[model samples]
Target chain A: MTIDASMRDALLGAVPSLRAFAISLSGNVDRADDLVQETLVRALSHIDSFQPGTNLNAWLFTILRNLFHSEYRKRRREVEDADGVYAARLSTQPEQGARLDLEDFKTALARLPPDQREVLLLVGASGFSYEEAAEICQCAVGTIKSRVNRARTRLAQLLAVESVDDLGPDDQTRAALQATG
Target chain B: MAQKRAREVAEDVVPGHVPPAPPRLDRNAQARLGEQLRAMYDDLLQQPIPDRFIDLLKDLDDIEKGKSTGKGTTG
Candidate 1:
């Protein structure tokens, strides 16, 4: 069956977040948008299979993540990114030093294993609860938690963020300090 | 050695003011990292959706409607 009006609107509403997740997971805008296009195509064509009243965002994210794993490395041969688009985006954000720090964080993010990166994005960034992230990843909540933990640890190492001060440019730093201090 | 590092941390996080102690570094770091993750993702979210996606969805809507009227716009 073709996409109905509601489903069409739903799919369109989901495109931006889906693209954000895709971009974060893949670390390449071009590839991420390609994945988003393919995902929308797949979702619209397979509207029959989708169960309504569920979390549509999570569903789209699952599709995008699955597409990345199934075809990302094979299709691109793993050399397609490092194109400086991400770095270019960072340079426009803030002061010179923080921008460089953001550049390092982005590189560190890219270095994470895809699964860890996906879980991290799902739970840490995208506002998905551990349970929702688990459902999207088709794993247990515990597994999702672990990946988030490991992803954080490894990212800290990569960014050389030995302590709170080293986590450069975060406004949340004060709240975190207050909460736990 | 640890105290010195904590002092440096205080200077960064509280600059010119001293903290009672080096407020547990690990948790604060986690929060900061997560903050950065969202910040970066927010950048991606801020980007305009490419026209290709908009056009593709529009085309799908047109095709779906056309199919019902016996005037399919599948192209």
Candidate 2:
């Protein structure tokens, strides 16, 4: 099926967020890019299967997730970089505590099992609702919720975070936290 | 140390006895973690899309347009 301009435009719009999810999932920029490229190609080829007027981002994400599991996961053992190689590559300006916190968060996130991490990223970071994340992960909504809860708990334990105050002083972070709290 | 503590906690619980529930994050703590998660995600979102990705999209567009037709063309 021919990919129309509007569909192409939507695919372009989704790239950044899709890349973000890929990096967070794979923890490698090069691998994430490959995954994004693969996802876009797969989505375009399967355009007929994609239902219009639904969440394109989620559809693209599902494609990426499936690709990661089926294709990338097998090759991971062969090409996996040492843990923290990608995290170390991030250029954080000196004395930037927020960036440091993000680095720490990434480390903790990488420690979670892929299943838990996927749920956390979808429900916690990417702002997908439980139902939406469940649909993407092909699991029950309750399973997604519980996985998110476990992921948060595991992250807090890993980071040694005792209180909300320990999360740093970013106003947006505080506001988002409070809203969810 | 955390792993050891977890192991200790597990060891202390008898088979038939329900141990006290593990400490759960309070609402405030949960919110804080959520905030941090969002912040990290936001930082990731700010990363520039590499030129290669843009180029790939263009290539896909071209192929879809029947400009360059081949089965094994993609890299």
Top model by TM-score, which number? 2
Q: For residues B1-75, could you state the per-residue lDDT of candidate 1 as single tens digits?
A: 698446444544553564333233376577667667777778778888799988998898898788877964467
Show the lowest summed lDDT stretch of 10 residues, model 2 chain A: A172-181
Any idea what lDDT model 1 has?
0.72
Model 1 chain A lDDT-worst window of ten: A172-181
State the lDDT at A48 in candidate 2: 91
**Tens digits of lDDT, candidate 1, A1-181:** 5587887888888888998898777666778889999999888777777887888888888888888888866866866755554545434445666566566778788778777788878877777878888788887655565566667778877777666455454546434312211
Instruction: Give one digit per residue, the lDDT tens place, for model 2 in B1-75.
Output: 697445434544434444343467776667668777887788779888788777877887786667546554786
Q: Which lDDT value does model 2 have at B1?
A: 64
Candidate 1: stretches off by over 4 Å:
A73-98, A165-181, B1-25, B71-75
> lDDT of model 2 at residue A4?
75
lDDT, residue A145, model 1: 53
Candidate lDDT values, in order: 0.72, 0.75
List, residue by residue over A54-93, the lDDT tens digit for candidate 2: 9999999999999989875677778876666545544332
